[model samples]
Target: MDEAIIVDAEFVAPVGTTAGEFVPIDRAPAAGLLLLVAFVVLYAKVISKLGKPAIQEFLWEIITRIVPSKQLRRRKEAQLRAIEVHTQRSNTSSQDQFAKWAKLDREYGKLKVEIEDINNSLTASKARFFTIISSAIFLSTTGMKMFLRIKHRKAAIFWLPKNAFPYPIEYILSFSSAPLGSVSVSAWLMICDAAMDLIVTIFVALVVGVIGMLRSNKVKPKTA
Candidate 1:
């Protein structure tokens, strides 16, 4: 009988992989999702900080530049200039020139009404434009997020150790048919968004605190 040789070999997990679990070879999708969630969270924070009116005004300016209604704007400007000229003429004319002054005042009134109409038209157009753009943006972002979640519904970002948490907590992490003890796409997205929001809040608080301290120091009186 031939003697069998047994060699003891220690098992080593691949670098960047857990000891017992096999990690996905391509982590791009998970990583990209994380980055996307973080960016969205950060952008929301920035928009809140800037204030909605400020952002709306900024967007409106951009829209005006891109979709210029030069003719309407020019007409409004000319009407305003004519109104100014009529006021100057009326002011200089004496009671002896009552007819001329009255004619100028009537022209001014017509110009005012025309300008008001132009303003209303412009406001209505802006409202419609903003509505369309906002709807498109909301739909695109929501659709993309839904697609990603559905595509990666069963995929685990990473696995937790068995019994890492209580049953309820584990179930929550493995939500929507994901395997137990693993974080699903939806869970990971929520985690990333929460983490990013926390980080941004902390950073803003730190910056504000530093600025306050510097301002206080600048105004403080030095004791001899």
Candidate 2:
């Protein structure tokens, strides 16, 4: 039993190492994790902001699906009538109130076909933003874990860039840490890389999307 316990413990991921380090599947510092999560959330917010209208349109599309699929105006009217009947039935029992509320909700849902249709697209875009950001977070975490292993000289999954400047980022694998005066050359390199990533993603998306959009617009007629 004790041997089994020992083997089980070996596989368990520790929250922090003996000297106070958090590793997601490997011992990484909390600060790195914080930055990764922040980036994920912020990225999601950015995507959501950009796709808000599309998401709204999708949601509104769904309403038409549920309410007017066959254009069942009679079913909707029947629910409205049910609401009227239930409303007068009694407040004596909780079930009666719930039944009334359910009918009213269903009726309202039926009436909000256009709104739901618009909202369906919005909901989809909203969900997609979260999914992409979540993926980014997953990849960042995996990369960080590999980086930690490199820092500790434990293992290497891939070769670090020959030109890549190294920082004693491993030294900051503790809570009692702060940025020091006169940023390291390696830190500057990291900063430049991050800036380049942001600028490039934006520029490429804009240049590509705009080219397609402009060409399409030219060949298209203006809608009245």
Candidate 3:
């Protein structure tokens, strides 16, 4: 019986080119990874600024506008108005007006039930709106990352110095079947993402500090 030998092939540049040589075509993968990192970071910052509630509310408003929930909203408002009117009428009525007071109380109870129904419907609609938006965002980000990873699986984003790190670290950095001492798509993406996040954090902190200083200066009493 003949043994089958498995040969692992490394990525090779064009003829006469070295493994880690800088080629003009290498810029595409590097730029793509950088753009992805920047986009992710910017998206995170925007989402943080808006907050989950604000995003959900924004989507809900758009959904309501498109679906014309105005009728339900108007009904809810009318119910509230009716309830208020009943309360006032009951308050001004005398004890001898027992029948009228009873009718007003019954009408108020019905109005409360109607308003509760409208509120429940709106809540469900808002939840669905947010769910759709969240799902779309998740799919888009994940899909882009996966597509890039597969497309550039064997492409070196950039080359590092020879023996830049120990063998173990180099192996890790060259993940997804990339050459040693070369930054692969996955590794470059991680680096870019971390660096971008750090920069964003520092920028936000500086902005907050500057705003704080301006507010303190404005509120500070002038020295006599």
Candidate 4:
């Protein structure tokens, strides 16, 4: 009877391995990983720092640009005038006229209230959306950092304070312990590199096109 040999069974069933195996770390890859960690921290910081202001400004700009303020004022003034007219009529008119004006006054009041409520609700929704998105980004980064710390035993380089910590102390301690150089250096380099590449590519493309256009014009014979 021939025995079947299992090849790389340990690899296939790594969980079954009793003792841990040592894997060599390469500096290049390690540096790259650190760089990635730095990028995540910096990107999150940049977004969180700028995102709120940018979104707020953009929302206000949209409201200002698309909503006709003049029209809104005109409508409000007209509604006010209608209420005033009905009030004056109700004061001196017959019972039937008074009843009709009273109904109109109530309806206009409700309508104005509803309009204000709707505007308030819309404003609240915009703020909620901004909060939710920003929170999601922040929580996601914090979760990732937490996971890395637990699984890889990596030190916390950059991370949000844990919810378990007390407020002001948490803020002070977490920030004080942050590895700012590790977090920011690689991130800035990556950002600068990307920006420079984009600029150079655009400049080169424009120059090439202009040169081609000039050459074509020079070579073309003038029409009589």
Candidate 5:
């Protein structure tokens, strides 16, 4: 019987490994991780404002406290009746069901306003919640780029937060310098990587984009 020879060679897997593994942490990686932790803490704070689960829980807490069970039951029954009627009547024109739609839209609006009020209260308790968060996330993203671009130096100009720009701006800087730095096969390779990234990002963004736009309507006043 012929036995296959086992070869020891490093190869990038065609399909990447998805598993738990340890990479030795150095100062730079550790510092980057620490910064990531800080950003995440702040990001959670921001999402607490934007996130629906938090808001739903918040509303439910307040709702259970104030609204009587009888009232909540009646409201639920009413909503169910409207839904059942619409379901049973297959021939009902969607436009002709303006009243039902109006009711739904109104109820949805009330839910939205309640969520907004909680968010507003949260915003007030923590003023500049969105601005500060957006700024921090954007700055951290840009700072990562600047750290890569500017040589490791102790100079304040390089180290200062003032040097950081908006998130999109960093891409512009990196993209522009690309022409100057990418003069060989290396540049071409980088472009391929960038194109792959852009394609994935755009695809993801399109999915998010639809949801994001719907949120405006979801969060807005009910107008049939």
Candidate 6:
């Protein structure tokens, strides 16, 4: 029992380290781990977003399939009644039929406008949600990359370009007992990189918004 316990103790290494004495796995800091997780989750989310149309279509099919027979019959009957009424109106005197059709056309135009407004509102809501998610993802990646630079004295996954005129960014320190300390030149570079990322994200979002506005204007329905 003692020998078994001793052997098990040898295998149990510190958290984030190699299990055995001979085997060495570099212990990644919490910041690095966070960055890795953030990248993975974000990548998966983007993929899911790309596939949303297909998923929605599949769900719609299932809903249609599972609709109650009585409800389906009622819908079919309503469609037939609408067709009958339209046919009756069409068979009336030519002038009367034309007047009726004009009224119906105006009503249809109004309904279409209402539907378009609803769709635009829904799209705006979705855009806001996407913006929030994207901002959170970007901030996490940038902040963690900077934290790793300060903690590990290593080159982060992303870094900023050297300044035209070099400045002393090293020697900055944190008085608080934080996991990320030892601020140096590299840390400042990481901070600069994060700022650049924020600017780029905002610019890209603005460009996208402009493109969306142009597209909507181009495709807007002409009023009769």
Better of 4 and 5 by TM-score: 4
lDDT, candidate 6, equals: 0.48
lDDT of 6 by residue, 1-224 (tens): 22222224323444444334435322334455445535544443443443545544454456557865444455456455556655655665647578877765555555455555655664665566556655655555555545544564543332223232233322232212222223333443444454455555666578669999999999999999
Model 3, range 105-215, lDDT digits (tens) per residue? Answer: 777777777777777877787678788887766655655566767887777767776656899888888898776677777877677667666677777788779999999
Model 2: lDDT equals: 0.46
**Candidate 2 off by > 4 Å:** 1-202, 205-215, 222-224
lDDT of each: 0.68, 0.46, 0.69, 0.53, 0.44, 0.48
Model 3, residue 43: what's the lDDT? Answer: 67
The parts of candidate 4 lying over 4 Å away from their true place are 1-25, 51-104, 154-224
Backbone clash count, each prediction separately? 0, 25, 0, 0, 0, 0
CA deviation > 4 Å runs, candidate 3:
1-29, 41-54, 61-68, 92-94, 162-167, 204-224
- Please, what is the TM-score per model? 0.66, 0.25, 0.65, 0.37, 0.24, 0.31
Candidate scoring better on lDDT of 4 and 6: 4
| lDDT of candidate 4 over 1-224, digit per residue (tens) | 12322234322323433334433222122455456555655555554444556756666568756876654565567567657756665674556677866776676676677567656765676677667766666666666555544453423333332255456644443333333222223333344445555555666578669999999999999999
Clashing pairs in 5: none
By lDDT, is 2 or 3 better?
3
The C-alpha stretches of model 1 lying farther than 4 A from their native spots are 1-29, 48-52, 92-94, 140-144, 202-224
**Residues 1-224 of candidate 1: C-alpha lDDT, one tens digit per residue:** 13322222323345555434643333224566556655655665655454556656778888777886874786668687777867677576658787777777777777777777777888898788777766655554555557657887887667776556899998999797677777777887678667667777787788779999999999999999
lDDT for residue 202 in candidate 6, whole number 0-100: 65
lDDT of 1 at 136: 53
Q: Could you tell me which 10 consecutive residues in candidate 1 have the lowest summed lDDT?
A: 1-10
